[model samples]
Target chain A: MSALLYLVTHKLKNRVREIFHRPSELVLLLIGAALVVFVVFTGNLDVDPGAVRPRAELSAIIFALYALVFVLTAKNGFVNGASMFSMADVNLLFTGPNKEKTLLSYGLFSQMGRSLMLGLFILYQYSWVHRAYGVTLTDLVILLVGYGMTAFLGQMLAMLLYSFTSGSDSRVRLAKGVFYGVIGAFVLYFAFLVLRAPEGELLPKVLAAAASPVLHFFPVAGFVRLGTVGAMELHASHIAIGLGCFAGCLILYYILISVLDMDFYEDVLKATEVSFSAITARKEGKAQEQAPRNVKVGKTGLGKGFGASVIAQKHRVENRRGKVLLLDLTSVVMAVVTVAFAFFTKQPVGALVMSMYLMIMTIGTGRWAKELLLPYVYLIPEPPFRKLLYMLREQLPALLMQSAVTFIPLYFLLHCDPLTVAAFILARTSAGWLFIGVDLLLHRWFGAGSNKALLLMFYFLFCSLSCVPGAAFAVVLFQILFIPLSVSVLAMAALNLLLALLLLFLSRNVLSASESNNQ
Target chain B: MLQVNHVTKKYGKLTANRDVSFQIGDGEIAVLLGPNGAGKSTIIKCIAGLLRFEGEILLDGFVNKTLDAKKRLGYVPEMPAIYDMLTVGEHLEFMLRAYKMEDDGTADRLLERFELLDKKNKLGKELSKGMQQKLSLCCALVHRPSVIIFDEPMVGLDPHAIKQLKEVFLELRQSGASVLISTHMIDSVEAYWDKAYIMKDGAFVAERSASDTTEASLEDLFFALTEGGADA
Candidate 1:
């Protein structure tokens, strides 16, 4: 058997065995099965164009797919790469005496598998799709099919683009020029249509224009938009164009292989090296930053050599060499974009929601959390509690800075009460501490070397369980005791902090020498 | 002095090291010689306090994994654990802070001796394998611990670094610091080992002093014992 086929078969067999054998996973599967049955039989999935505007929904879909495409393009760019193969594939399949096109097929197959996994996620959002977009079951199914197809098509395009452009700088620039030209032409075309339409009907006209076949679908940015919109609306002309474009994507995806003469082994090795490093870091609950390298040498100094001062100084040096500071350019851009979103949506909580997204994202970036993965942190000859405090000092301040950037804007824009601003900031910071505390507790109990999937499951469970107590307590306290909102939020923050401290204390010896490598 | 008493390490059902006991006194060099999967690294990790085992380890008089023992112990792990974000110089600084000791020029001396002074500003990730191994040695040597452990210390080093490390082992032994080294390389084991233990199947199968039976060379004796009735 081929390496790719063998791994895929082996993994599928394992997954099936796990589903069939394990009681917990089996129960979850059964519940999901029951939910699907319930939805098919008695679920209220009816839709009415009478209430919601289908055009606006179409507009949302177009913008949403565009955003996804934009991110996909950015990730597949030379500077920021993407991975579609496992390390095993990189090692075994790439090194095998196979053609580049064969490897490409393997990569494409893996991408389709990923899309299938994500399709399950889309199925879970069916009710929201029904309620928000007035999409019926049939519309929802078509939409999901469009989504999976588009994702597969996007990967195909990315591979072709990467294969064509990545070998040199001039080629990359040329590729970018062509790409931006297409987007620019579409933009101007879009502006022309919208401007020519009557004042109240611009969006409807733009939506109609987006579905038209003048936009070629193989280039994907415009064609994918056309195909997806066509699928959602069940337009015969649109579906025909969509299927034709999809077929074109498949053919071009293969043709590009022979045309570009892609060095699949080299490309995969590079991709897999990066992917494996990230996977390793994430598995160890570490930050995902490019490994620091090629920095200008400076004088070695650990001034004062105080108890925790060295850690703080290390951060400063790291910031100087790499992006040690949390509030770097990316944070600035994220803040601007998030604030713009809130302003455009005219939703005060949108700011908070965006901030929460930023919070979750920033947690995964460079942080003290990642420091634990390296053995030095554990091997450090210091009091575990003191070391813990030192790490917290570095981590908590960054969390605070992020929260300040997030909620401080809301304080002014929403004209929130002083108490509301204070509660929001404290509650968010408390949530950060709660995450660290639970992470430490889990690391101590489960061991840092635990399987990545199991660790993630525990992390999700903790995120769920941790949110319940504070929110539940606040809600029940408000309904029964009639506490003021500020007091309730403050009390919840205090409760979270108390729990965090208790957890930290309980897991204080997490980095102690006695702790073994069970990973 | 470093002591590992009846150490037994298991990974679920597989025993990596079992009933392994050994000791090295002050100013003594001990070598644990084994082939791949011969339980050398497992025993070394158990001694370095990186793995849990069903036994006891002591550095000087303190429990090996205790903070007190950690302060006195320096370990050069089999695989150099490079901190990507830290430069060569900063790694030494980090050791100083962690051990709560002033540099007193020890770091500079080690860096200078290892010929890494020119590359002190290079981050851990920028260094080649040889450089990484040299930096690992520098990190382990900076604090001037009373006990030091090296696991396959010569594996990735260039000839220059291998020579420096061999010199370091002798110097460490001369300074009244006990040194425990684990390696399959006969040459690395030949010059430094005062006491040699051949390990296989998770336990020490044979032990001999440097003064014991010079007629049979270490390599010849190793192969004979390892491939003999014990199937070591």
Candidate 2:
């Protein structure tokens, strides 16, 4: 236990020292802290003060989110178990002279820290939450505590379930059956409530169902939700019952582990290995996460191209496997969600903006980025500029397809002219190119010395800076030239495309200059 | 043929390879023997045109980064980096196509030689580490490169595959291709290397040839150079 404490303290001390050692990372951290402070104090992300949402509505949303996270976490744990331990922990602590109970406590302690960190994401929404719910500091802290507890409880339950059912097929089956049955019952109960209501508006009935005391009796999510809602509404009994239930669950888990003397090393090993590999793959910018377990080697060859063009062919083949059309599952989902959002809010352009933002956020995870990390892209016998163009070939088509799928429906929804539709599609697809350009430019500048936090800060900064020229052009065309909005949009799109091309040409040397430490 | 003229590479202030000059002529097999952090991989990467360096590297009398040179050069990285989505067979085909080589069953033959023919249809992710290394080797070889480089190639290879790789090196040299192998596993390359360079502190401390090392084995020479002080 003392060793574990020493390890934790040293790890924390070193992590702080590491941040300070990397000046750029330290600067980024400071900037992040400044931004958080500004946002929290401002009580708004933007000029418009957030509209106060109903407390029941907020409660319902949080409850739904908590429930979804719990279910997914449990399902994953059922198969692979929950891993609070990393590969290093497995290698060092698991093999060291430490009691199992102490090690378990250390794992849970680390897990609690992670849960707290995860809960901090909600702090970024401080402005909106405070404005919308009239939340005080104490209320916010209570909610944060509730959220962290919910996360911790979910993992604890997952660990217990895994330990109980591991290595026994019948036990797993029975556990899963019980799990599904409980979930089914809750859904049925909610549906029954909604159906039996006096049927004026659907939302009130749903919120009423969410606020029902019956939900507070179910499990961890409910208990946490009750505590949070109770805190928000200042209900003492609700808080006690809700928080007491969570504490009871934790005590139960501790007793089970201590009494059963469960050997969970094997169970967590698989999850830890999976997590380590996945993290490594992400760090190396490998898009291997999308790969299905069972790949059908339908075709055995690239089937086309020589030299640099084979890269495009390789990407095409990989994309084909992941998608039926040019649009993959994610694209389809984005399109559907965008259309639904537009239909509900009657804000086609707003939905288009949201979808484009989604695309921009995800551009770094594409195959082109992965290509740069691997050796073949540099080893291929071609001019750097030409190789880059070929590398981007597959991305362009997919971006176009995604934009078309996302925005074409908006033509009808917006009741807009064809030119307007074209302009929106062009702008959206062009943003992908611009973001890709920014990614390449950053890589070209930083090369192998790129730090994630530093690069992320620069990535956003560069992206925003890169958009200025096109935006200025659009503004001039629209405000000065008296051009229609669609025409201005088209002009902006053209400028963005040209800028992306220029960036591509400038960043071509990234292919030649970039080095992988893996070598 | 490959020529590395006074090449130097640095990562920030740390010099990974300092004024490293070496050459491997056609039909020759040269091994770079170095301890960890001895700059073997750095020099290999510089020669492969994957890193920016101060000096010149020429393959077949062309700049290493040029199309002509790249076409003739093959590099197997120290860690096998195979595409998770691409099948083992597809990997070779992609390499062949990338190198503008005719698909003349070289892929299959190489797979057979590496004992990867049965798992040719397996996705790269499905193969074990040793198998992935085998696939990486097959990709590098399918192009029939005139100059081939391997960095720690035997790290994950099975005994049979290692033996097969040594044979392949001889075959490649017989075919008049230059082979440069970077490995700390001195015994693996002792039997066939025409020349060996022992590197320390980012520079070659000693060079030995097969004909010159009659009095002392490569193992003894390496220990004398690398571990002599620690031993004393």
Candidate 3:
């Protein structure tokens, strides 16, 4: 076990060294560290008298951030290109003569660094701002232990979920739906509590109730309680409660890690078989129904069309339908959920606008669009612009489908007015087209797959931060410049349309360049 | 010794292997010959305990249906299966950690033997196809299991790699480990193999022994058996 620990540490050190060695990464790390330090020290020095419950508020924020990290890390491929637990090293260790417990410990510890860094940052910031609740040595120890335990628990839970849903498309879809539903409910509940709360008493009793059990037994909860009590100068019982919570959380983590199925790793590996079977079965059923009639006439027509130039373009368009549907569905579902949650919380306008914006962004720049639009030119003989226009025409149904799915739910659920609905749809459609154009431009230059996803995520993040600039622009056009609503809308629409056309043209040229380079 | 007894594997409605049985004793090198989709690789994977089969595979009379039995067997998949981000040295280190092999000079010796010593620090993705194949072979052999199963192991190997692999198999045979290699490069390794099985559709149709007929080549036997009108 000691030797195994040593190996894990060595591997981790090597990984960290590799990360730090990269100039770009080093710069980013330095910038992030500087920002975090600036935020902590500056914020700590200027303490507000009214923020008496700063510790508790910070604790709640930390807990929420932890949950967000869990969801995002689990949803996105973190350690490996597949999942956190899907790293080949785990499988290799399992097959080796090493003790399973030792391997599990190493695996869990190896992946906990990023989570720990984030946790420590939050802990330090909270501790600094609330000097009365400054972390004692014992509190820091308890915080570290609690963070590690919770991370392990979260990892195990994610692995268990992957084991059951990884290979089963239907199951994965169902699981994702349930996960989204739970998150939605939590958000709604929190919003309700906030809206109902009196001024200076925004903390819900439910949050306290939720924290009590953990505060009484889990280390993470215990640390929060310690900080909160320390800040309040509460009795010694606060420390006792925090210690008890920490101990309980450790015990639970041990039980989960030790008692879980040993074959879980194997099960995760075999899960993809289920999805493959489901897809194959669906394909077979479709084939049986469509085979005879379509086979006889379609092949002849296709061959004749190929011989001539007339039908060549349509065939290319038809080939992209599946990909379009896939992208559209992902966008629509995310949009509907985001919007529906906003509507239920009585923020109907915000929900409508955000949903429309998200829908446009998701469809325009996502992996689905890149996969559909970028790859099929090799089989077709046409002007690159013509081919792209044909491809966009093929994607029209999917675009319409996405719009309807997003718009109908908002309109019906919120009883939105026609003008608001029109404004929302038109704005979203233009935004969507503009985004798709941007995505096409990026993809034409950078290539596709997960790289494209990463780029899109970064683009969205930047756009979100630049909302101030966007809002200022909107304000200038609408209020200061006194542009009429109709005129503004038409101008914005025309600008978006022109941008889309120009981008499409540029994308075609880029593709042509790439093809020539390949040749 | 490895014993495959009436083992069958199915993927939904498609049967990859059907009632296939074969045996290779210690010090014996057996080649599985087949065309594409001939269930050769399926049988190899089943023997290696990577895939569940209907019948039984026994390694030295111990049925390899459990993890314990599997630990004694080494499997090289058809593809070059190694983490792209990991260097050749790191890949070996991981294998050592996973298999609980001591950090001795065994892996290093294999690297030198395969002429991969210089490229040990290169990532798997940076390696040429042939180099990747060699790396994979080294990973499978690093733990030194009693039985080694190769599924199209020579797919991307250069002539030099092929020669080195042949030598490696001979060394493994001398070490008393049973070897089962499934490959289309039958003609190249034909002279070294002790026994060969020819598969067609989903079953082994013919078996040949070098001891029985030294003149008969695996390619001729494989073609004769998998040909359209050939009888099982």
Top candidate by DockQ: 2
Best model number under TM-score: 2
In order, what are the TM-scores of chain A for the candidates? 0.75, 0.80, 0.57
lDDT digits (tens) for residues A1-519 of candidate 2:
488899999999999998899887799889888877887778843433345556776787668757756776666657667888989999999898888888888898999899877776566667756765666556777777877888887787787778878878898999889988898888899888888889576667877887777887656888888888888888999889887888898889877865664677877777788888878776654445366545666766778888889998898887666443577666776677677556544565567666765675578777777787778888888788888989988777788888888878877766767887789789888878998999888887774555677788788778878878987898899899899988998888899899998988788787885563344
* Candidate 3 lDDT tens digits, B127-201: 887898899898888878888888888888887878888998999999999999988877778778998888888
Could you estimate the TM-score for every candidate? 0.82, 0.87, 0.46
Expressed as tens digits, the lDDT of each residue in A306-377 for candidate 3 is 211322333332333223333344574566465544443445545545664555445543322332321223
Give the Å error, residue A318, model 3: 10
Query: Which stretch of 10 consecutive residues in model 1 chain A shows the poorest summed lDDT?
Result: A284-293
Write down the lDDT that model 1 would get. Answer: 0.70
Best-to-worst order by lDDT is: 2, 1, 3
The residue-by-residue lDDT of candidate 1 on A1-519, one tens digit each, is 876688779988999998888666776777667766665455455666686556554544554554455445444745434567888787777777877777777777878878656655456545645655666667656666666776676666665566666668898899788866776776687667667777664346656555445544325545555666667666778678768867876787678755665565565566667779777755533345563334554655545445545776676666666745667655666666556455434454445545554554355344466666555666677777777777667667776786677667766655677786677778777877777777777777763234444555566558547756786777777778998766777777888788878888998977664332421
Which docking category, incorrect, acceptable, medium or high, applies to candidate 2?
medium
TM-score pick, better of 1 and 2: 2
**Residue clash pairs of candidate 2:** none
The positional error of residue B171 in candidate 3, measured at the CA in angstroms, is 41
Candidate 3, which segments miss by more than 4 Å at Cα?
Answer: A1-3, A27-87, A114-152, A161-250, A253-257, A263-265, A268-376, A390-416, A446-473, A481-494, A513-519, B1-232
lDDT of 1 by residue, B1-232 (tens): 9988988987666889889888899999998887679988777767777677788999998997788888888888776666666788888988898778877999989999989999887778788878888898888889999999888889888888888888889889899999988887887669768998898788787887889865577787689778874332
Please, what are the lDDT tens digits per residue for candidate 2 over residues B1-232? 8898998887787888888888888999999997899999889988888888899999989999888888898899887878877888899888877777787988899999999999978888889999999999998889889999999999889999999999999999999999999998888887899989888889888887778845578888788888855321
- Tell me the interface RMSD of every candidate, in Å: 3.3, 1.7, 25.1
